[model samples]
Target: MGKLTATFLKEIILLARDRSGILVLFLMPAVLVVVVSLVQENVLKTAGETGIRVLFIDHDRQSTGQVIEELLSGSGAVEIVKDVDGHEIDEETARTLLAKGDFQFCIIIPKGVTDGVKKRVEQQITEALNAGNEAQNEPVPLPSLAVYFDPLVQGAFRASVVNVLHRVVLSMEMEMKARALSNMIPVRMNLILQEIMGPNLINVPVGIFPRMDSKWGSERLLDVKIEPASRGGVEELPTSVQQNVPAWALFGMFFIVVPLGGSLIREKQDGTMLRLLTLPVPHVTLLSGKVIAYVLVCTVQFSIILLVGRFVLPIWGMPVLEMGSSPAAIVLVVVSAALAAAGYGVMLGTIFRTYEQASMFGPVSVVIAAAVGGVMVPVYVMPEFMQKISNYSPLAWGLNALIDIFVRQGGIRSVLPEILYLLSFFAGAMLIAWGVFIRRGRTGG
Candidate 1:
């Protein structure tokens, strides 16, 4: 027990004196969280979470055009720009801007759409109403809408925009058809009544007919209720800070492998490890001390990032980090991740004979692990094979557990699988290090 405590204190002192190691562990992730979160916030805005800027040139400048602008504005999905440089934007100018990628979308309402649509719709309804006759009404031409999009716009985004426009136009067309039918119904009824009793209907007032409203066609018959999918808990919306903080914190924590590996290499090269092996204490005790010291460093690293995310990030107009109700789960996850990281460090140190090899390999391997683990992008968004590959990364396990707690309002049980995976990885890595350490001792080179 005394040996273990002494070794732990020594490791801590060595780590404190290593300025480069301290910088790698602390400053890098702090800056990563702040910069990446702000950049992602802008990405969210571009995705229309806040709003997308759209160039709307309504050449028809009548009812259909006015209605399109009003409905788009009410939906709150886009910022409508009808004018550019103090002048009403023409179709040619809007097209030029879209092609240049200065604007993502441009909508043009073709001329005579309103009058043409109304005339065509009324004629179609009239023809349909008198279907028993010869049906001699000619087909009237209707103007189609033109929607120009930037070449770089994604297919999904274009589909979404097209869908919104389709719904709005369909609603307007249905209302127009309804109004035309309403007008024709009274006319047909009055003609029949007059033909049947010409003199008897002389004093009849027009007020006897039922009133029709344009809004009636737009009202939905059945409504859909949207509910959140949560574990019957208060649903927390994930913000950029919430995501990047945990992601890069895991990144920094795993980076402990660098210093841990370097420390091991230094001791081996200086004959300190050989001298320590001569002592009565088991090598596992020495490893335990290194693990404990680095785990404490990792915990502090996680805390600094949390504090920055909760307090400092919000000052930059970011959402406050809402750690879920389970603080115990968070602590457990951090410790498990730190242990896994330390074990990897010890393994690398045992295998490598020089600090340069350990330093280069340690950071590079961690970056590869982080890349596959959903640190930079969510696993679901990756290609199919990469998604399967991500399941094997320890960083993925830690990141998943943290995200579950941070956004899903999860508890200990919610992250049990990830915790177990991380702990298993720690155990596996240590065993490999032990095997390597014993083999080298017997060779006596």
Candidate 2:
């Protein structure tokens, strides 16, 4: 234990003395998080607050079209704006606007919409009243509302507009029915009364349809009930920070490979390994001390990066990092991730033959792994094929576990899978390093 402690302290001192490496460890990820967060600020807006810009072309100069326009304008989910430079635009121009991303969607209310709706409603009611007494009327085709959506808009936004349009259609149909009934009911009642009373009784008041009116109130034609589910207690960070902070931090953490491999190569070249082997301590003790020291180095590295995200970045006009509900679980995640990174560095050190080889291979491997792991782009935004392959990257698992804690407000159980995967990577890497050492021992090289 004393020897291990001495070796650990020596590793710490050597790592601290390297000023340039320490700078890169802390500087790169901070710059990335700040730059990327500033650039993608709009994409990280909260749900229901996204103001989708829409172009409304009301061709039907009638009440129904005007009502639909009013409905969309009032829906808070979207913003209805005049075309570029406040110029009036037609359907073709609106389509062009949608293509240019000036508008998220285009709504075209076709001509004769009011006439078409009334026509359909009258035909349906007449057919219903006279069913079996005469041949049914053929269904009238109503004019369709043309909706052109930009392919860039999310499907959820498009679906929301579609739902609103459905409500408009239902409201239009009901308005036409109410008008038809208001005019037809009095005439039909008078006819029936004259037939029953020899056309001589006092005429019933024209407004006596109140009895039926009370039974069929047309105020709310569609009753939409929403049963909302309970949400989590924690407030999450913007999507960008939630994704980028840990992602780039993991990228930086794995960069420990450079110094770790370089350290091994430098010691081997100085005949330090031979000298250590001649000491009383077992080979595992030396390896354990090296891994332990670097793991602590990695832990400090991660904590510094996290502190930048939590405290420093916010001062630079960026979102502050939310450490989540379970700081203990966060500690576990950090320690495990650091262990995996350290083990990977050890494996790289054993595999490479020289300082140049270890230096070149270490950073290059980290870049490839970080790229595949979604440090550059979010896994959610990646193509399906890329997302499928992302699981192979250990950095991806490390970032995922961090996200579980940070964004999902998850406890240890939620991140257990990711923790286990990182531990597996650490175990596998250490075994390979051990195997390489055993091979070197047998060959006496």
**Model number with the top TM-score:** 1
Q: Write the per-residue lDDT of candidate 2 for residues 27-86, one digit (tens) a residue.
A: 776777677765655554422546666788877889877777776666666666656686
Candidate 1's residue-wise lDDT over 197-222, tens digit each? 88677744556778577677778889
Count of steric clashes across candidates, in order = 0, 0
Alpha carbon lDDT of each predicted model: 0.87, 0.77
Instruction: Give every collision pair in model 2.
Output: none
How many clashing pairs does model 2 include?
A: 0
List all candidate RMSDs to the true structure: 3.3, 5.0
Q: Which stretch of 10 consecutive residues in model 2 shows the poorest summed lDDT?
A: 209-218
Q: What is the lDDT of residue 196 in candidate 2?
A: 96
